[model samples]
Target: MTTPTVAVGALGGTIASTSSSADGSEVVPTLTAELLVAAVPGLDEVAAVRAETLARLPSPSLDEPTILRTLQWAQAAVDEGATGVVVTQGTDTLEEAAYLLDLFWDRPEPLVVTGAMRSPAAAGADGPANLLTAVRCAAAEGSRERGVLVAFDDEVHQARWVAKTDSMSTSAFRSPVFGPIGRCVEAEVVYGVPADRIPPLKLLPGHAGGDPRVPLLATYLGDDGFIVDSIRADDVDGLVVAGFGAGHVSASMAEAIGRLARQVPVVFASRTGSGPTGRAMYGYPGSEIDLVARGAVGAGWLSPVKARLLLWALSLGGPVPRADVAAAFELRGRP
Candidate 1:
């Protein structure tokens, strides 16, 4: 029997959107799977589209349970011989969940998460079009080998490389160092398989939102780092410092991070959130080069949460190779 194509849904972000046009100002989108599917055309022919309304929360409001629930639903789809999975979520924290799902799923099926900037009632609205394209990508046989992907604004990006740049631009999602896997046209989807870390993505026990154990602290000039003191005094298990560009923490923060790393893992991530976190990329008060030399683990492209997740996994004894996790955020050619 031929491997049939099917879809699994995890309602998020724009996919569950509603228009504010009727009420005048302050029209927040009220999203529903039924409404979103009706908006997209040609999805029926592509695969067996199924919807799971896991949450109606905004992307930034997405929590750990959101990640786990969506993953669970997708895993069931794959087990039942579904060829692909599509997730519709808000753009704000899309990468965070995408990276998390990519790490959690060991299955060899495509997981594509797509969301939109414009809502259904607005002119130049793009949600329906993006959703249709995502379904097509999920249905495409070629997508299976690519591991986890996030298809947005017609561009197919590998999960690990994509970042949401614009607040509300059609050209929002971009993979700076690497371009998209390919673009989805009306007729077809095209892309070559990339060299991604195969299954056995060491399982990492996730942390809930507002966990007093891990504090993500930022460092700036003349920064008192009272938060750091608070975190230390209260027994934070891990700390992620958004150091200066290129991953440098404040001098005082650096010293504090160094001490903290000895006690708990101190992950260095860039506030830039788009580039690799490494030394020698810039000259500043707290350059990453110094941090790495100080035994601080540099989170190459990982945003703070991603870096935290990876560390939490490693600390919990997940076998996801350190080098693989390192490669997740490192510069393209460097990886």
Candidate 2:
């Protein structure tokens, strides 16, 4: 019998954190990937684990560059004949990271991402359990072709639809549009929903080098359009507006957004956090339909964060026309 190899890429988050002092100790990302894998009791029984420390930072501190680096590491692991890969990081930005990975990772092997809410020093820390499940899922035959997954609290969430729903609970990640696609039960990976085979994003030749700047701004009540105007002064590549219910904004704000859209690609996503932005439902001045008429791209069901990442990637491809940007969103945002 041969054991499958699973590569573990460690990017420090709460799962790899520990208290630095006895009293008034502040936990930080201080553990290596090898240490995290070693802490799991039965990880060896699941697969031959190879560990690599990619970065050491709390997830909130992670930027687009770190994510691109992590994707490279995962591909390197797969090239080394590993059956799958596991990424351990902070839960704060796990959902966004996972979605980005899904967009770029075109391989068939499972790429599972997991994180911990409670630091290792805390009582009943869930890191070990989550790690164990992540490894098992990564190595499982069932995980292939499922796209990138966020495994936490025994649930397997598809990266495209998952969100960080809670702040401090072990069950922090959830896929609201479509519930988790699978689960890890007592070390066994179980598939509850059928796989939705969507093609990965077609990145340009030199995407990583472009470093396109896309800013995400959220709309609020009585926002006097100053912030929108303020962004005009800076050199920004694209913009994502997290607008109100069904992607509406104040009339003044809408006008400002329209002007910005003419300058750069402007994407509109719902601020309510769930559901897709309506394409042509409402016809009011500040409605999503109105915004689209003004040359803003509707984000469909994609959240603001995911929409920003997609827009950034599109911007990196160089001189992306509005139609190309809208088509990219349509390809990824559609069910």
Candidate 3:
């Protein structure tokens, strides 16, 4: 008969934005966690809630340091005996932020993230609905051990597979490979599919000082090797090439990638967003087979954003062996 404690942390986004004046003026993040939770009708019916405002900036303004700090805050909430935690931020980087948290959230309690596509002042604001559903999902016993979740538009998506597929509309987030694992209907959370658990990467708290900068390059038609050549002269520690189709670049890029692979770690991901990068599908110049033979690690099912984060994390632990880098993806990059 007792409700579990659910901690809700608010990082300012459209969910918290409001017009400064009654005459419909400039809108900004002006709502606090307490205000947000107060707007959610029947939220108290699900769980005992605790609210806190961690930041009041758009999600795009958030950097790695801010994200790392927020992660620490979430951990502290978990340590304080919160059964589950919900975070509200901008939808622009919700998928990426959730994925980053998944890599570090080594806990069984659900960490549900949600945000509104429309501002609170807009017609038919979704913030209240999303916040309420996020709390319900977080309080559910079935949501535990499912990794970080992005709950929006009544659907719950796993962090690793979810992406922002649309610019507008409430149905913006989607998992191209794996669909929603759960949905919130009439304040009840129903899980439709079982989610696989991925081992969290080993990243110590407050130890994100010197993560290596890894640049991602998306290949295009008639693309010369100028960018790669330019990056080769820079101080970047790693590169993730988002190749066309199933990972194919122009022949000129292949030659540059071949040369760069010898100097630094090169990860090949698909610019198409989702799908496995081909390993031996083609043997022609600039083919996936050719790139793999030239030591470009195929990023199997990992998006370019996630691939970049993984490579950066690996590089932060000092010079990792090439084989170890390949094994990291092989072991943890599944969709």
Best by lDDT: 2
Candidate ranking (TM-score, best to worst): 2, 3, 1
lDDT of 1 by residue, 30-117 (tens): 7667667866777776666776566777777886566866887888888987888888888888877887787677777788888888
Candidate 3: which pairs clash?
none
Give the range where candidate 2 is weakest over 10 consecutive residues by summed lDDT.
201-210
The TM-score that candidate 1 achieves is 0.84
Question: In angstroms, how far off is 28's CA in candidate 1?
Answer: 4.0
**Which is superior by TM-score, 1 or 2?**
2
Winner on lDDT (1 vs 3): 3
Number of the top candidate by TM-score?
2
Task: Please say which candidate is ahead in TM-score: 1 or 3.
Answer: 3
Error of 1 at 109 (Å): 0.8
Q: List where candidate 1 sits over 4 angstroms from the true fold.
A: 1-4, 20-25, 192-195, 198-200, 204-212, 279-285, 315-334
Compared with the true structure, all predictions reach lDDT values of 0.69, 0.88, 0.86
lDDT of 3: 0.86
Structural similarity to truth (TM-score) of each candidate: 0.84, 0.97, 0.95
Over 122-220, each residue of candidate 3 has an lDDT whose tens digit, in order, gives 889999999988999999988999989989999998988899999988889898877888899877889987756887877764455565778999999
Displacement of the residue 26 alpha carbon in candidate 3, Å: 4.5
Instruction: Rate residue 329 of model 2 by lDDT.
Output: 88
Runs in model 3 deviating more than 4 A are 21-26
